[model samples]
Target: MAILSALRLTRAPGAAFVVMGLYWGVFAAHVPVFRDRLGVDDALFGTLLLGSSLGLLSTMWLAPKFDQGLGRAALPTAAALLALAWIAPSLAVAPMAFALGMVGVGMASGLLDVVMNARVSQIEARSGRSLMNANHGLFSLAYGLAALASGVTREAGLPMIAVFGGVGLLALGLMPLLSRAPAPAVAPEEGGAVRLPLWPVMLCGIVVMIAFLSEATVESWSALHIERTLGGGAAQGALGPALLGVTMTLGRFGGQGLAERLSETAVIRVAALVSATGAAIAATAPGPMVAYLGFAVTGLGISVIGPMGLALAGRMVAPHQRSQAIARVAVIAFCAFLIAPVLMGGLSEAFGLRAAFGAVAVLLLMILPPVLALRRRAAAPLAVPA
Candidate 1:
């Protein structure tokens, strides 16, 4: 029964990841339209991404509380369903209305992330193995397929809204499946009640945030950097994101095997070093091809960090206390992700895209120590012989 439950819960996150990919696959081309619809400049547009993060943070805070009465299914359902449900408002021609719609979408996504991830932790506990990386990899793959779909659509000059809205509508099909899945968590937990060592998890949170920020920065800004700094054409520029996504998916797919062969601590340390170097190289690459190579290298280096870190966090603490701990770490990670797009956009606007990626490279370097600590924390306390 737990195995079946794990499979069902696992499917929810993978499906959600793929659907988000589908939406963006065709919708990114509408960036200018979304900008125009929001009545904002590039900087503000970047800042606006915060709405989603904020929505995510807020929902993370509330999901556990809501789950108290609504049961485990509550958070994921809220998270999964609303991302697509509010599209009607998002499609409105007005900027304020569109922004409002984005807020709804962001909040829904954030709530869903909190719930789904919490469920992921639960699923891992029940299954007694590592499944986080593969699940997240599916998310990355969905993101790639979505972006590729968008590129093909753009070449046809289709209405971006039509493509996105169609994708949004298709998300409706997922709701029924999600509704049938068993609730993994019963309630939002009080940080006050958690007995886990906050310092260790807190440290893990910082590293996770840095990794997330690196990923978010590349996801949001790599293509722009390639185009503006490396002189890529429209197609090349567009391909930059797809390249990053594909590389990341491939890296993550391979990460599980690598994790089995090494300690998570050692893997994280090496991966962080490689990622930081890749970021630097990408920032300075003389042309697009080099930049793409840099992006792929960075992807491979960082791919394992996310899943390994999250799994360590889950195993480090007691089962009853895991959700709040995970949430604490997740909130910190979301803050980094939330800030990434805005920060990159502002840096790009003020200096150039190259400078922005250089900043991400620097942040990626900071993750190594904490990841090592998290790994040590997860290892068994050696039993002394009587």
Candidate 2:
């Protein structure tokens, strides 16, 4: 019963998923609309989008710091700020205004990303079980639903800004729930000093980095891959990402239970290998339908890595040190969010998008050694008190 209470308390971050979903689903679908409305060419639109990505990147480092100062209250407030800021750009007032708004959105949403997850970690500690994957899957679901709704809202001639404003208001309404969420068990940056036998934590971060790279590529380019590589229609192209989202969401849902049933090491190993296979198949598939299957496989394979990595970090360290340790891992992972797009984009530019993807596919094999190290550590006997 106490554990249930704690889950209820820590669960406020789930609302963040809704806000993120609303924001991501809407923006991703409406980028072309915004570009046309603003008279910006593809290059300019790309730059603006990159700005938002940059804002998100900025928050990756500050996640631990933000939580240190504000704790549980940070998410809703930041989320509200993010939603409110959309008012300027969604309305299409001016180019400079939209730029400003995107920057603020980026920063707020990015910070909230880390803070909310950190908060969940606190909850997991109190609840004495794993819940991160489910929480994130909920996030994925929210994004998918919101994006689905965005399409409906768009067709109804509703301004994207209005849609965003309404979503933000909903977020505001939910802020109290987020605020009331129980305080997490540890500070956001609690685990800073524990040393491991391998992977430099930073290197482990890099190992996982490629996985993120592939995800970003799919997020940014799946539609294009569908349209160009598979000769699919625009509608089909659009659904490519949706398919990816659905697969990832489902994967994470199953992943949560799987992580519990098996060692995270075994789960991640299989997951990576599966994801690699998916990426490779998608990269080489000759048609749209086949490509999407590959993407789905990739999504399923990659879904568990994030939550598993986080949970492993928590178990590896002393309780007081966990938040910091996980925070460090998050920083590295989020950094991948920043780098993956550019790297994949570059690869896509230098040699077809397929080539870019194939490169990412090849790295999936390397995820094993570090996971094995974590398993060994987990299997070690606890020390007896002196």
Candidate 3:
């Protein structure tokens, strides 16, 4: 019965990931509409998107408290907030209103991100399993399906509000699943939580930021690149992100199987190189089909970085410090979301979109040295916790 309970509980985190992915997938599909709705150019829209990150940053400080205070309740509550907040951006008519709506979305997304990841870490610790990749795979699958569906819906002439409203309702429907899951057990070592070691944690945070920045660049900007730069139609442009999502889903499931055979360092190093190569291909792709292939390659290569990084962070800390440790790393990593859109928008505005993509390739390659350093240090005898 205990084993069965564990099996059942594991589904909660994956479901949460899917719900969040659905929101993002729909958002990605509707970007052109969003831009037109607010009457902003790419650069201005990027700046507006920064408001969500600001809101995320502001609310991140509360993550640990939520984890400590709410326990299992935290995930559902944050998810519910995310569901409601997702509608705000869909309702906005002006720039300020849109920005304000993004703030709410960011706050909710940030909270949900931290809590759900923490729950997954706890689940892995208890189950002695590598579940991160699989859970994230579910996210990518949902994202891909949602993006494709949204494209069809838009082509069918459904209003954005109606589309987004359905997503919000789906999230509400998933809330009950969380209630059925067991709460994570706090271990003895974690009873009195102490300060997590700053040096390694900071290093891990940097790695996560680089990974997230690379991934977000493609996910957020690829559609616009396909449509504006490559002259793809709406359905074809939507295919860019959708294809990325599909490949990422496959890659993460592959990572789940590989985790036991390979070290996190090994996986990340190879993944980064592959991601850089994919970025380069994307930067030079002359046509939409070629660009789609590039994005798909990029997705497959970067798929494991975020989940693996979070899993590594979880392993480094005491069981009790899981939520707080993951939160700290996430706060730093999520800043990529804050920076990537604006940076890419400015770069795309100044140089071409191709140039902007080239910069992403450079950023991905930069992870190699850090990954090597981490592997070397991890090989040494541990005097500190992580």
Best model per lDDT: 3
TM-score for each model: 0.84, 0.81, 0.91
The RMSD (Cα, Å) of candidate 1 is: 4.2
Model 3 C-alpha lDDT per residue in residues 1-386, reported as the tens digit of each score:
43234335578877789888998888887887788778888888889888788888877887667766777788888889988897778989999989999999998888887777668777776777666677778888899888888888878879999988898888888989865555645534534537886766677787889888887778778888888899987788788889889999989888876787998889998999888888988899999989988988899989988877776776666666666667678878988988898989899888978999999999988888877877876676654453
| Tens digits of lDDT, candidate 1, 1-386 | 43234345578655656666655444443454456566765576677666656666677677666655566466446645665645644576765565566667667766566555556666666767666676667667767666666666666766666776667666767766555545755444454533567677788788778888888777766655765678875556556667667777877877778877987677788989998998998998999998988888887777777776765675577766565567677777777857786888798789787888898888888887676666666686722222
What global local distance difference test value does model 2 have?
Answer: 0.69
Query: Which pairs of residues collide in candidate 1?
Result: 25-146, 37-95, 56-110, 64-188, 79-112
Q: List the residue pairs that clash in candidate 2.
A: 9-182, 189-323, 189-324, 190-321, 190-323, 190-324, 191-321, 191-322, 191-324, 191-325
Q: What lDDT score is found at residue 371 in candidate 2?
A: 78
> Candidate 3: which stretches are off by over 4 Å?
1-9, 67-72, 184-197, 314-325
Q: Sort by lDDT, best first: what order?
A: 3, 2, 1
User: Model 2, range 87-111, lDDT digits (tens) per residue?
Assistant: 7668765566667777777788887
Query: What is the full ranking by TM-score, best candidate first?
Result: 3, 1, 2
Global lDDT of each model? 0.68, 0.69, 0.82
For model 1 the local lDDT of residue 185 reads: 51
